[model samples]
Target: MGAVESRLAELGIQIPEVVPPVAAYVPAVIDGDHVYTAGQLPMVSGALPATGKVGDGHGLVPPADAKEYARISALNALAAAKSVLGSLDRVTRIVKVVGFVASDPSFTGQPGVINGASEVLGEIFGDAGVHARSAVGVSVLPLDAPVEVELILAFV
Candidate 1:
């Protein structure tokens, strides 16, 4: 296995197959020395684990669960990046991460939720995972997924 894959295995993290695009875009594309991934949802075996806006109140997905979803979405993004590069070892650094949270109007914890993704990347890649990021709260997301993540990676 590649060093990145070995690292993921050591952490007991299995990168799933890249989530198929719901629309017209490809899962990832290579540009110069970087690979950019499309937004990824927390899909498992072709289905979303949960759905709804995130908040602490009734009828909303909890921020903690949403955080886990963001982590899964990041894994999906990594799968796409590896698919494009043919191996995760090609990735030298994570460049940027952009996460969107489908949120209840009162929820303002987008950064904490996106930390799920960031933390996982840190566990897998150490300092190479540190990157610029943005976490946004939105009214809704496609498929009502609670969180979505995308990534940019610099590769050899």
Candidate 2:
């Protein structure tokens, strides 16, 4: 395994196959030295493990579970990046991350939820994973997924 893949293995993570895009867009595209990934949902075995808005409100997914979904989404984003770059080791730095949380109207924990994705990137890439980020709260997402993550990676 390449250095980045090895690190992921050490963390007990196995990058799944890149989720096929639901629309006309590609999963990732490389422009110059950066690879940009499409928004990735937390898909496992070709399905979303959880779906719904996240918040303390009734019928909403809990914040903790949403956080986990964020991590899974990040993993999928990593897979998409690897698919384009051939190996995660090709990445020189994580440039930016944008996370969207399907949230209850009253929910305001978007940053905390996005931290789940950031934490995993930090674990896999250390300081190189640190990057500019935006955590957004939205009423819904494609496939009703609780979280979605997209990444921009700078590579050699």
Candidate 3:
């Protein structure tokens, strides 16, 4: 296995199949040396694991759960990148990450939620996973998913 794949195995993670797009766009596209992925939802077995705005309230998806969803979304984004690049080992750096959180009005923990994605990438890629990032709070997301993530990767 490639270095990146080995790391994933060490972390007990198996890169999942690229998520099929919900709309017209492709999952990922290559332009020059970078691979850009469509925003990915936290899908398991082709279904969202949870759906709701994230907040502290009882009816909202808790911040912790949303964080886990962010991780799953990041994995989906990685799958998209791999589909285009044919291997994650070609990734020289994680260039950028943009995370969207479906959030309640009172929620201000978007950054923490996105950390789930960042942390996992770091574990897999070490220093190469560090990147510029944006954590946005949106009132809603496609499929009402609690979190969504997209990635930009620089590859050989």
Candidates in order: C-alpha RMSD to true structure: 0.7, 0.8, 0.5
Each prediction's whole-model lDDT (CA): 0.95, 0.94, 0.95
lDDT of 1 by residue, 1-156 (tens): 788989988999998998888999999999999999999999999999999999999899999999999999999999999899999999999999999999999999999999999999999999999999999999999999999999999999
Ranking by lDDT: 1, 3, 2
Per residue, candidate 2 scores C-alpha lDDT tens digits across 108-130 of 99999999999999999998999
TM-score of each: 0.98, 0.97, 0.99
Question: Clashes in each model (backbone N, CA, C under 3 Å)?
Answer: 0, 0, 0
What C-alpha lDDT, on a 0 to 100 scale, does residue 1 get in candidate 2?
70
Local lDDT at 59 for model 2 = 92
Report the Cα lDDT for residue 2, model 2: 81
Q: Candidate 2 clash total?
A: 0
Q: Model 3: runs farther than 4 Å from truth?
A: none
Tell me the spans in candidate 1 whose CA falls farther than 4 Å from its real position: none
Name the lDDT of candidate 3: 0.95
Candidate 1: minimum summed lDDT over ten consecutive residues — where?
Answer: 1-10
- Candidate 3: worst-modelled 10 consecutive residues by lDDT: 14-23
lDDT of 1 at 108: 99
